[model samples]
Target: MTLKSALLAVLFASTAAVAVAQTPLPPADPLDDRSAKRVERMEKVVRELRSIVFQGRDTGKPVVVQPAETDAQIMSLNQRLSDLEQTLTRLNGQNETANFELTKANRAAADQKARADALEQRLVALENAFNDLKTQAAAAPAAGAYPPPPAPPADPAAAFKQAKDLLLGGDYGNAEQAFSTYVTNYPDNARTPEARYWLGETLFVREAYTDAAGAYIGAIRGWPQTTWAPDATLKLARSMVALKKTADACRTLDELTKRYPKAPANVTSRAASTRTAAKCG
Candidate 1:
């Protein structure tokens, strides 16, 4: 063979062997049995090609011309190695794609499981709430089956003090009942206007704004000169605003400024701000 041709043949064989060696090996478990076997066979073929390409290298034969039959055998081995490598490449790509699809499917399954668990918990909460309500309804007394406790006695000072204590103690529900009872039992008491104002305050703290307005109105109109009167007027306007009765609240604030001209500076200032927020003319 010509010297240049022999050198070219050696270079080509060396390049092909190195390329095959650098090609990544297939993973042991890529979820495709057939692809795994193909990769395994490809690896064996690469090893055989390496043996053929460098067979006499240890004996100092980098490139050796063989008989025609040996050359044919080398060519056959090279062709088979090339085919095996192509098959391995295709199989590895397909395996990677299939693995990605499986990962997506697993993620979707986990997401569905999480949603189902959340739904089950919500259903359990709803069932528990319904059962509690059903039990409460079953246990509740029919109308007048149980009468309310006796009205607070008509001791004007002591009764009103008890209700006021309940208010200060943050027992707003009982304070509401106590104040209502006090107003009922001692409507003509000397502290009736103050009592009414405090009742409105109790309701206001409990977010019963409409009821608070009625009680405040009582304190303002029934006993206008009482110490509670100015504060009650202020609170009545605030309660009207809270109830979203914009016009009524604005009119009430106007009335507070006009009718209670001697009201405190802070009360007047707050009413002005309230008027602005309510967009009053």
Candidate 2:
């Protein structure tokens, strides 16, 4: 090529190189420091080319610009830029993989927590159900253990008569049960107090002195003017003496004398014997 054409071509190429080097790089570029150093080297080369052109022009001499050197520099700069781009691509891929793994782990943890909570709720429900079943079992009566007593007759007098017949027949077990039913079913009946006294007799015969005392007390609660009152009182004192309650037996005997001044000789004699047994004054 001609000397002037060669000079013009070299100048144009150098100017283009400066323009490319001066272009603003994207802010997010990972190889910013290396790219800036490359730009600085390109600016120094441009300065050297301008100096060579001006010196050649001033001296009126032909400048030999080697095309191979320029081509080699451009090729080296392109190779460096390609390496930087590849590095940035690899880093972005690794970042995306790490983010994906972290998100998956978080989701797995959340799922595990949810399962644990559900299991805990199920366990709590089972425990509550077990407690409820235990409570129901405790409250319910045993099955077929003891049959219920027969129902009392509808009429109060008939019920009382039935209990009295059971007592007169010497069926003390059935008489006690029947008299208890009569007393409970017919509390307002005139015969209820007498039934209570008869229930005490059945219990006394069975040597259930504690229960007999309670039945006798219930029969004479208001000191009924019935024929059985004195007898029931004397039996109450005898029951107290059997229970080793000497003071109570004495008090009961005194109450019987005061309450029933006209008590039968047999009942009074029995009270006196009970007081003697208790060693009462």
Clashes of each: 0, 0
Report, for every candidate in turn, its global Cα lDDT versus the true structure: 0.79, 0.87
Segments in model 1 whose C-alpha atoms lie over 4 Å from true places: 1-153
Candidate with maximal lDDT: 2
Q: Report the backbone clash tally of model 1.
A: 0
For candidate 2, the lDDT comes to 0.87
Lowest lDDT 10-residue stretch of candidate 2: 141-150
lDDT comparing candidate 1 with the true structure: 0.79
Indicate the residue-level lDDT of 70 in model 2: 64
133-241: candidate 2 lDDT, tens digit per residue:
8888788856323334467789888888877887887778788898998888889888888999999999999899999999999999989898999999999999988
Candidate 1 structure quality by residue, lDDT tens digits, 6-125: 545865775686677557666774447886676566555555555555664445456444445556999999999999999999999999999999999999999999999999999999
